[model samples]
Every structure is written in C-alpha cells, then in structure tokens.
Target: MIQKLLDSGLHWEKKEFGRYGFLKTSGSTDTDIYFVEKGSVRIFMMDENEERIIRFGYSGNIIVSLDSFLSGKPSELYIQAIKKTIVRTATKKDFYEFIRSSEENLKFWNSILEDLVLQQMEREKDLLISSPKERFDRVLKRSPKLFQEVPNKYIANYLRMSPETLSRLKKS
Candidate 1:
C-alpha cells in the first residue's frame, strides 16, 4: 500500500551526494524527507561548539527533520551525508497530501510514527542505562555493516563516546 502510494503520486527523485555533503542546514526552511537508497546520513545539531549527533540513517531508512518538516519552521538540525549516498526525496507538501488522501494512508502514517516513537524510547533507555561499550555493542549487533560503511569518528559520536574509547572497544 505504501509502495503503491509512493509509486503513484510521490515525486521521488534520485539524488546523489558526496561524503560530508549537507542536505539540509540549520535555519533552512525547505524540508524534504529522504529515503536512503544507498550509504548513510547523519542527523545532528550544534551543541555550543561541538556537533552532537542525534541519529544516523542508513540504507533502507528515512531521514528528515521532523519538527521543521511538520511545523514549517526553520530546522535546528543539520542532515549530512556520511558517505557517498543516493537517496529518494519527496517534498513536505507532497508527503502531507499523500497522508491525508485516504484512510489507509493515515493509518500507515500513524504506524510509522508509532515505530519512530518506540525506537526513540529504546535509544533513550540505552543511552541512559548502558555503558559506552554496551551502547557500541548494541549498535554493532543491530548493524554490523555500520562499522564498515561509516567513519569511526562518526560512529563514536553517535554512540556518545570518544574515538579513543571506540578504538579500544573495537580492539577488545
């Protein structure tokens, strides 16, 4: 059903970006949700003088700044390519129209939201209760390919650990 909707009306365009390319920057009003076709993207925000990674979206995942996309406000986060990437993107207007077009679409949207919420809760729990090693282990268990696909520094940042700690954990 979702595929049908995407195929029928969503104007998906294939976009390619080089590593470290910025898809959307802080204070940008244009909001487009991207489906990763290949490679990865990192969603992050500036914290004082540092880049605080919020999440990493790999292949077969969707990436978007939810607040900016939904509220029609400028984004506070930066979405950047972590590797040479290909993604299919749909504008915010097209996405919302599709969601409101039918009951099935609405249901699908709700389910996606539920899944996002649950994932967020689980990540929060892991971050709050797990050690850096434990967090790194959990991520590795979930996506071993991430290590090969993304830079060690980005992975360390995502796991809220220093690069040195990540190196030690990998060695162990």
Candidate 2:
C-alpha cells in the first residue's frame, strides 16, 4: 500500500538526517507523512524525563505522527532519526488529495490506515501481558525485523524493560 503511494509520482521532498536528527518535535503541528528510503527513524515522547519509545520506521516504511496529522494540533510526540536516514515527505493535504484522486488510491490509504489500527491493537495486547517474556515473544513474532534494525537499548525501552533483561531474554 505504501509502495503504491510512493510509486504514484507524487511530489515528495527527499530529506536526509543524521543520527538523532529530529523529523518532528514535541509541541509542533507537523502533519507530514514520511516514507523511509534508507536507515531508520524512531517516534517517541518524553514521559516526565524519560523518552518513551512509541514506534519505528525502517527502510520502505511510511511513518507519521498520526495524532498530529489527524487532529491538526500539536502533539507530544517526537520523531527522530535512529541513524543516517533518507526519507521522502509529502504534506497532509497532498497525501489526501492524491488518495482522493482515484478509488484505488483511496483503498490503498484505507488499507494503510487499517494496518496502523491493527498494529496499535497488537501493541495494546502486548502491553496487557504481564510477563516480559510474553511481550518479547509477541513483538518478535509480529516484527522480527525490528530486532535487526533498532538498537537493543531502544527496544528494551519500548518493551518497558531494562537493557539487562532484554539481553538475558536474547541469550536464552
């Protein structure tokens, strides 16, 4: 679905970011959708003082701060580059206009939205599991490639566990 959008010849601004570079910052109304071309990006927010991991975008993935995009308001979310990354971006208006231009594009957008909702539900289920092992296993089953693309420290944060615990689980 995302590939279809990328292949649609829509005007996209190709941008590059160094490690820790921010794509979106907290307290900003940034509704741009990004398509990752290389490397990776992390979507997070500060919880008190701690940075809470929310989601990640790898090569070939489309990412946006959805809440901001949908609500047209500033969000607490922050999007950052995990490494040297290249992404193509389109404004919310352009994206919607493109989708509206054709029934097929609309279906593609719907599928993408559906997948996002389902992924959120799966994350909720993972959070409901009290056991760390269960959460680890569930995520591994769902997105095994995450382990390869993201650093263990960030993965541990996303799983709400310590780095040592994640290491232990990996070793087992």
Candidate 3:
C-alpha cells in the first residue's frame, strides 16, 4: 500500500515516535494509517486498568485504528510506539482512493483484508485455548517471528500468561 501510494505520486511526511510515544490516543478520531518504516508499535485497549494488546505492527507493516478508519468515530484503542519508530502516513480517503484506483491495488487490499480475517479467527481460537502452553505453542508455530520482534512481556500479555510462563515455555 505504501509503495502503491508512492507510485501514485502521493508524497507524505515521515513522522518519528520516541519510545512509548502515542501516535493515537484513545477517544481521538484519527483516520490516519501509518506504514512502519522502522521499529514497532502495538494497538491495545485498557480493560479495567489492564492493557490488552489487540495487535502489533512491526517494520514494513501498516498500523491503524480500524474502528476509527471505518466508522469515523473516536477510537477506543491506542497506537503506541514500542520503540523509537519512523512512519509514513496516509489518510483513509487517500488509502481508499489508491486502492480503488487500480484493479491490482483492489486485489492487494482484498488480500490484506483476507489475511486480517484469518488472523483474527486464529486469535479467537488462541484465546479459547485454555492451556497456556498450548496457546504459546500455537502462536510460536504460526508466527515465530513475533517472538523475535516483540518483547516476551508483551507476547505474554497477548497470550494471556505471565512473562515467567513465556520464559519457561521458551526454555522448554
């Protein structure tokens, strides 16, 4: 999508986020999506004081508040920088226009949506798995790069386990 936009003669500014900086805060209606040029970010919501991570975007990934983008409403999720990051942004309008501008781009967007659906289904299945070890193993088998790119503590939260449990699982 980033490349497609660039190929379309669209120019964008690259923004920097220091570690722990917020790109979008909860309750803001920001319809912008960012391509992670470097580093990583996480999309999460607070659940009674607990931060539940919904997703992570690593280098070369696109990050956005989907609800806000789709509904044009205040977002309940936070897009936070996990490390110092650089991102190029596109608004929802530009994104839609770019994707609809070409048949190939439309197919590309469709493919991305399909992958997101599949990933969400897998995440639901993972949450339903009762055993921490099983959840850990399933995720590891599916996205081993997650373990490499994301911190164990955040991964543990995503897996609904303690960081200690994740460490033990890695050791085993």
Candidate 4:
C-alpha cells in the first residue's frame, strides 16, 4: 500500500539534519517525514523560551501533523535528526491533491489518520492520569531500546522532568 504511494510522483527530498537545523515556527502545511531507508531521526519541541527533545523516530515511521498542517497554521512542534539522517517529505498541497486523485492514496491517508488519532488519545490519557515518573516508566517500557539511541537530557524533558530528577529516578 505504502509502496505504491511512494512510487507515485511524491515530491520527496532527503537531507541531513545538521547540528544547526532551526526549529521552523511557520509551517503552514502537513509534510510526510520519512527517514531514508537507512537512517533515524529525533523529533523535538521548541518554544521561544526553551527547547525540549521529544522522540526518536527511525526508518519507516511517518511524521505528520494533521491538524496544524491541514489548517494552514503554525505547527506546535519542530523536528530534527539526532544523527546523520535522510528524510523524504511531501507538503500539505501534495497530500490533498494525492488523496483527491487516487483511491489508494486516500485509503493510505485514512489509515494514517486513524493511527495518529489513537496515539494522540492514548498520550492525552496518560498525561491526565500518570505521574511524571510513571509516565517515564511507561515510555521506557514501550521502547526499551530507544534509551540507548537518545540522550538522557532529551528523555528527561520528554517526561516533563529535569535531568537531575531523571538521574535520581534512574538510580531508584
């Protein structure tokens, strides 16, 4: 399914996320974030005052901001690669046109939307009820392997705790 979509004239380009990639604040469209067939990426969240590292995304994972991109508004987050990475991207204009022109594309997008919604709901629920440490543990359990790939400070921020607190929790 996805293979066909990729084969379509999806204008995707690959670039390395360097040490100086800025968190773009004025994105007005959704984009397909794909790691090259060989690399990985780190997603980050940044505001005017501070920056927070969020998640490590590997090859085959899709990065789409449905709400902000679809609405032609600024996205709430920024993305960067933690290592040498390559990504294929398609903008919001391309997304809608593809759906309107092809059934397969539409179906693929629908499935992606469902996955995003379910993940969003789950994250929201976790935020509502879980303590900081509990949330941290949950993330670790879900992706036990990622801890080795991402830095400790990034993980600490994602769990809404300081690096010191994460260190203390790690000991206990």
Q: Write down the TM-score of every candidate.
A: 0.89, 0.97, 0.93, 0.75
lDDT by candidate, in order shown: 0.84, 0.92, 0.87, 0.65
Q: Per-prediction count of colliding residue pairs?
A: 0, 0, 0, 0
Ranking by TM-score: 2, 3, 1, 4
- Ranked candidates (lDDT, high to low): 2, 3, 1, 4
Best of the candidates, lDDT: 2
Q: In model 3, where is the ten-residue run with the lowest total lDDT? A: 2-11
The Cα error of candidate 4 at residue 98, in Å, is 2.7
Candidate 3 lDDT over residue span 1-172, tens digit each: 5566556754456899999999999999988878888888989999999999988898878767878888999988999998899998888887888778789888987887788788889999999999999999999999887887889989999999999999999999
lDDT of 1 at 122: 67
Residue 36 lDDT in candidate 3: 89
Clash count, candidate 2: 0
Native-referenced Cα lDDT, model 3: 0.87
What value does the lDDT take at residue 50 in candidate 3?
A: 98
Over 66-164, each residue of candidate 1 has an lDDT whose tens digit, in order, gives: 888878999789999988999899998888888898888888878877877877786787688569988988888877887887899998888888999
Residue 159, candidate 2: Cα error in Å is 0.3
- Per-residue lDDT tens digits of candidate 4, residues 1-88? 6666678887767556655353243353434545344355555566677876545566666765555665656676666666665566
Q: What is the lDDT of candidate 4?
A: 0.65
Question: lDDT tens string, model 2, 37-109?
Answer: 9999989999899999978889999888999999999999999999999999999999989989999999888
> Looking at model 2, which ten-residue stretch has the lowest summed lDDT?
1-10
